[model samples]
Target: MSTHTSPAAGPDAPAQPQGGRHAAGPGRAGRDGGLGGVARRVSLGRPGDPRWARPGLWGVLALAAVLYVWALGRNGHANEYYAAAILSGTRSWKAFFFGALDAGSFITVDKPPLALWVMGLPARIFGFGTWSMLLPQAAAGVAAVAVLHSAVRRAMPGGYGHAAALVAALAMTLTPITVAINRDNNPDTLLVLLLVLAAWFCQEAVRTGRMRALVVSAVLVGLAFNTKMLQAYLVLPAFAPLYLVMAPGTSLRRLGHLLAAGAALVVSSAWWMVIVDLWPASDRPYVGGSTDNSVRDLVIGYNGLGRIFGSGGGRGGGGMGFGGEAGAWRLFNDIMAGQISWLLPFAVIALVAGLALTARGPLRDTRIALLLWGGWLAVHYVVFSFSSGTFHPYYSTAMAPAVAALTGLGGVLGWRAYRRSRAWSWVLPAGIAVTGAWAFTVLRRSTDFVPWLAWTVAAITVTAVAGLLLARLGPRLRLRVAAVALAAGLAAGLAGPAAYALTPLGSAVNGTNPTAGPAGSGGFGGMRGGFPGGAREGGPEGDGGPPGGTPGQNSQQGTTGDAVPGARYGLPADGVRGGGPDGAMDQQMIEYLRRNLDGATWLVAVSGAQGASSVILSTGLPVIAMGGFTGSDPAMTVDRLDGLVSSGRLRYVMTGGGQGGPDGGGSQVTEWVRANCAAVKASEYGGSTDRSLYRCG
Candidate 1:
């Protein structure tokens, strides 16, 4: 087998497998016939790679599948907000395309519809259910682990690349928050997958100098942009510079390629937004989060700058401070640390160490890998740390890939330094010690949950650190000492996160804020509350109210709601139907609405998506959200309601306490309903006092 290295990969780049440019073909088959050949090709690994490399990659993927897909149905419409959208999408192609909260296309979800399109297709085919809605995210999560491994493996040199890739994949698979998000229907799961895939393509472009690869990466970024809007472009800072510095070709040509790629990015990202913005507003659902009924405004205001500058027209208006006060320590705070920061400190140390170690290497040295992953970490760290927006702990999933990659690379680099350079031997032990200490601190925050694990991790850290340090002094015993040190160090580093990651398997996670671990496990304490009508604290039993209910009220009534059986989270198991954050309507209300559709275009109009989502899910019918997701978007007006009512398209209006916007303010539609519609007695529909049904027109 011959080896070929791209000029950009440098002379020291890892040797490619046989068959020259078209490796993983006859060259591999002819040398290692039968199963061995298949394994080599399946792994896409180098000739010197160990046999375990293939199985190790497979093992990581298997672990991820279990973490993401196991008992997924138990979640049962995890994030019913998105689940309702998926259900709508399953029933109506228009709703699917627009990410509408209802089949009638009254309002689109706050973000774009790509994720809905991804999850919707499966749900459409499989019949809408918990598994169909969430499985795509699980598959994407596993694929992300695989891609991150490939990116790290290809960037590092020789057999060490395989080891690093395995470590990176495992770290990502077990990163508590990553597990939680993948198990849910949130767009961030797909966003992380796309960003990592973009990284993989960028790494390929750097290695091969292929303009096509770079362009593909840019397209993936654009798709990611469509998935979550502005959040996808965060990788540009890391990707563009890495290619500019190390991609093969003259500076001018590389710049030209990037310019072309940037053009591709703009086109792919804007196409949908353009289409939506240009569509006649009356013909489509109102752009959910925008103050004006415009996709452009929604993108630039609610989903874009609103997230960064904290001034927008959506719910919380980006100033909700859901992830705690933004600062350098935000990621390490109790609300977030258990979710993603378990390996963050070590990844940072690894970044610094890896960069310093490769400082003198050629332009395409392994330092490019460090910069790619390190820059990603730095950019997200800064933005997430300081962005005073409506943040959630699951938002930290964006940082997991970078942190995992750096940890793997840094670990390999540290081991190599320890073996070859006496002066740098301390780097390996230092990283492990710091990681162990941080893990202990994080574990202590949940002492009751895992009383013995913190001290056990501390003891292992001391042993591993001591072993690694002493191995430096005794050359004869070094190999044995280092082996034990490596095992203990890995255990010490992964133990805390692995434990937290398993918590989701034991019980249902909060679909809305999807954090790992049992309640009070150093995760966000107010998970149930903070959203518009959700309770402020103490799960569903607290005084703040059932999700989507008025403050100081509990509207759970009737038979157990449509929340899938086995749903252990705060979701109402009582006869409350409409399983959304705006609070569920009693079964009788759903029945009344169903029986009285009577040629009405919509079964009912409610205050917000929170109020409308559950009804849409329960009835599989169109309902109108008078306001949008946050209940603040000017999606509805008194005139629109009167027109619909007069046209005999809207017959029922559910208004009052639980239906108000996030700010507890009522819209003109609500006022008009109160003035012109006849209120039905709560006893008639089995509805709570806080929520009354008004018959209009």
Candidate 2:
């Protein structure tokens, strides 16, 4: 290949200086001083940046806030599982640090406590409620958009930087899955933010040649790991290589810097695991998803390799059943495509064309931008495409940042190629054609949903492509024609996702497997089976049923036993009664527990967190999730149960709620409870005959 630089890849004027050290230069600071200066700087961006830059960034963030926080409490406690943990954390520092499911610290939530800590401290000050628990996630989502803008802007210099940055931020903010995940309490929201921040820091490292920036980027990745284990490391393939290739230094020196950053990553990621593992088992809650009550096993097993190879049990044994199957087309499958694939086709084209255009440029050429985003997309695409373990559509939120960044970068590069009359200018119209077709196909999948949309997208795509090709013939009209074509292309590209992204605003998304779009728009809507006691057979209208059922029955049945009524996917709506795993808690049961608690630390002990969560959230009392999340964890032993009972720390045990039954040593505890404890009648507690409450002392 020729070593000559492509116009698209050649050095351009820097929009912001390296290291951001000179962002507020002496002359600029002197002219605009004090808090007023800071405010102006914040509102207008750096003096060097375009006037539209900061305002566009704020607009993107404002959009994100509206999308994420508008109907924030519509879903109530969102994911009651995490909401319960956050509630507990607010009550006790131990629960806050360990991510315990109850105030009494019975068992920790499956993931690390970092996300819990982020939501918990605020809940502590604000008092736990729907808003307090989920607002932080919304804030994190907005911050992720801002940081992604900065990263993309930093990578592309001159006029292209501002547009690319704003486009990337807007793409991220409007991504359907990004909206769904950020609105709920899942750790994925914070994970996306941290990973995006890491990417920004890595860009800073490359721009400034500052080793500290690289190390900070590594530390951010470590924090992301704590937010969601091995999933966070997915960005490493993107981050490490970018620094090694683009950072200014000799190979040996760059390698040394990477090693130091690697060490920092290890320390930051391992510190919590180390402390938790070192704590005595007797004094701490058992690790919820591990075979052994050790954080190391939790990481190495359930949260790590098990999530990839599907071995260590829990939910990872069988795939989450949401992502269709393990194949390359999985992301585009009915169950997943709407969530994150709306812009994927365009992104792929961008990556290839951008890379080919910049292939001959110097090391620091913008090709590294393609490598960073493309590598991020590639690794996640492969793993998510093939990983046979516990996968959900929401997990694809991790891929949104890469897709958004690539979409922005690729669009700009393609535009640059077109403007410069490069041979690859055809790639621009081709990308628009491909993206429009894909959008039409995806929109067609939801036949009844805005029937006109698919055709509208197809029409726009045709018009945009024709205009682009025609613009080439008339150089005088090229600028105006191409501008309109590009705008139409952007509209066609974003229309599908933008429509799907709005669905969550109107309906309550399933907190567990949060997928965007109208009900049955590829989400696992039918998965909301009625819980054991009184949970209705199906969910709300437009919410698809599980497999086979009458359309009306499927759409109208309330999520009673398993799910909170009025909530999608069976999650509880605010003010819904909290009884057992099924949201079937009776007033009688609440009164019975209140009267009988005596001086016991626990109000009741149930098989799983689902069983414990509602009760805890309702009464603000300690309810032990004996077997942790799946009720399969050996979090409870017969000996420990005996000791708690003997010491008056426990009094009641409710068994059999369709939450997984006790596995391993927990089975022994169940047997002991059955053999020795006196069973309380269903009539007494107003509970179902299927699940019995035993009064043990």
Span of ten consecutive residues with least summed lDDT in model 2: 547-556
Work out the TM-score per prediction.
0.89, 0.89
Cα lDDT tens digits for candidate 2, 1-697: 0111224445354544432423555676686789977888899776666667788788888999999987665555667788788888877888888999998998999999899998877777766765666789899999998888888887776657778888888998989888988988999999999998888788778666788999999999999989888899998988898888778988888998899999999999999999999999898888888888988888878888888877755454456656788888999999888889989998999999888887774424467667888889999999999988888888999999999999988888888778775587899999999999999999998787788999999999999999999998877968789989999999999999998887777655566667677556544643232111012232333422222212111122324333323233343443223324454556467667889899999998887787688677666788998878877887888899999999999999877666665722236776798888998886776645434678898
* Tens digit of per-residue lDDT, candidate 1, span 1-697: 0114343554356644434423565454477678876665676544545556777898889999998976665555567678778877877888888889888888899889999999888766756766666778999999999999989987776667777888999999999989988987889999999999999888888878889999999999999999999999999999999999888999999999999999999998999999888899889998888878887887778787888778753343456665778899999887788889999989999989888888886524467788989999999999999987788788889999999999998998888778768889899999999999999998898667678999999999999999988887877978788978987999899999998888776544466778876456434423322211112222232111112211111122113452532122344544333323346666667777778889998988876776576666656678887767776667777777788899998998776435455313355666677789897776776666535578997
Q: Name every residue pair that clashes in candidate 1.
A: 548-582, 548-583, 558-575, 559-574, 559-575, 560-573, 560-574, 560-575, 561-574
Once fitted onto the true fold, the runs of candidate 2 whose alpha carbons sit more than 4 angstroms away are 1-11, 14-31, 34-36, 313-315, 362-365, 525-584, 663-666, 683-691
Roughly what TM-score does model 1 have, to 2 decimal places?
Answer: 0.89
**Candidate 1 off by > 4 Å:** 1-36, 43-46, 313-316, 362-365, 522-584, 662-667, 683-691
> Who wins the lDDT comparison?
2
